[model samples]
Target: MPAVVETYQKIKDLRDKDKHEKQKDYQSAVETFEEQAGALYEKLREKEQAVEQFNDTLSHGSVQAHAFVQHRQYIEHLDSALDDLQPSVQQARLKMEHARHVLTDAYVEVKKYEKLIDMKEEEHMQWMKHEEHRHMDELSMNQYMKFFNR
Candidate 1:
């Protein structure tokens, strides 16, 4: 409960709050990236399935020529779109990783501040105990002198 310990406690509280906010941000980033990747994969699967079904229909030998070309072009467009999305997904993953690192650093800072506060409190407690014992000794010596003199 010394002034120094109080200051350290205040710092620790601020650091802990910062750490909590960073943790939340990291978790949100992770969830966002995961959802994006999952949706992308699902879309890729659907596109691949569509292309396969179109190929199967072509083998039936009753499709119109224009419809065939249009289907092929649409599949090519889907491929290009998927390719374009991949870099954005990669960027999201990188952003999530950065958030995780920032959260970790914030947590470390909080712990260090907490440790410092604990050490300061311990030192203060020890000093208080030493002062109390010295005061008690002084009182006891005064009483002993008074009793002998009387």
Candidate 2:
């Protein structure tokens, strides 16, 4: 029938849509990672330039007791920033991995649930078959009684 065909087509279309959406999400995550990496690299270059500037300044000046203190402090700040950046970038990558893990877990769960449903349905069908046979036996007995009375 046309209705049956239409329903099948709709189911297929919905599955296709879901597949496309998942692909889009994967592409978007990759783009985000690339953009973050590029920005981090640019910031690293800028930070390096700051260190170079500080070193050049120190070279030009006569060494003073306080000058080393300031130089050390500047380098410390740079090191701390880099340290912080590492954890942040790592966290993002970890999030991506976690998302993948969650999807895998869901897939595994779906298979288990599907198997459970099939088992339940099979049991239900057996029960229905037994009930139908019982009813048919009762019907046959009632018909025999009616024929004898006639």
Candidate 3:
């Protein structure tokens, strides 16, 4: 029974480790998405600032028409890049959710194994108690018989 409990404990430990790894994977996915999204936002901010600056210069009659065209083109390119990254961000979020589900399943598995071990340990304790009672009864009966024979 102890051996059985031990085996279950080992199984639970393995499940726990697997769950931890899955959690790490989920966290990593989240971090990666955050990094990507942050970078895109930063780029968008820079582009917006550049556009504003260019507009200010144009208003002051200090910028060339060709330079304004180039800046507009760059802003359009940034917008397209942001559009491309939206899908990637969604995919990363989905991946993280999947990993979270996997981790939850692993946690459930570990709990199940631990519960089995606990049940087995309780059974062992009951069995030991029953055996001890039987042993005491036998000893008492032996003494009674000896006393009667005397």
Candidate 4:
């Protein structure tokens, strides 16, 4: 192969490796985001359940004022924590999407280089075949001339 084609092949190899790494990063990011979202939802559910239980208690009988205030405060705290966690989950999702884009670009680059290398190799093979045929024709012509002269 020509040096230029070899160089392209090397570049393609590097891009392929980069694509692999990007895929792994994307997978990890997705997993992290999923875990974060799951935890957030679980906490939200717990908070909801707690509020429902508190309401049921109030409906059933008379409750103390301090206990009511404390339950409200606990619910508020859970709400605050959920609010804080939402942004981090969004950030993780964004990171995963970005990684996916990078992986896609790397895959395209590798394919482009692969096509270029294939074209170059095909051209080299055709040129070699043409040269071999020309050489054979020349040898045939020489033999014909020798037989005619004799």
Best candidate, TM-score: 4
lDDT tens readout by residue for model 3, 1-150: 689898888889999999889889888988987887787788779878988888788788876779978988988998888888778878877887888788889889988998899899999999999999999999999999999999
- Each candidate's TM vs. the true structure? 0.80, 0.47, 0.78, 0.82
- Report the Cα lDDT for residue 118, model 1: 82
lDDT at position 121, candidate 1: 83
Q: Assess candidate 2 and give its TM-score to the true structure.
A: 0.47
Candidate 2 segments exceeding 4 Å error: 1-9, 94-150
Task: Compose the digit string of candidate 2's lDDT tens values, residues 20-138.
Answer: 55556655666766666666776688778977887788789866878778777877876777776777677667766665565555555545555555566667678788999999999
Q: lDDT of each structure?
A: 0.89, 0.68, 0.87, 0.92
Lowest lDDT 10-mer window, candidate 3? 35-44
User: Positional deviation of 50 in candidate 2, in angstroms?
Assistant: 2.0
| Candidate 4 or 2, higher lDDT | 4
Lowest lDDT 10-mer window, candidate 1? 34-43
Ranking by TM-score: 4, 1, 3, 2
How far residue 114's Cα lies from its native spot in candidate 3, in Å, is 1.3
Best prediction by lDDT: 4
How would you encode candidate 1's per-residue C-alpha lDDT over 1-150 as one tens digit per residue?
Answer: 678888888888998999999989999999989987987897799798988898889787789889988998888888887888788789889989999999989989998998888888888889999999999999999999999999
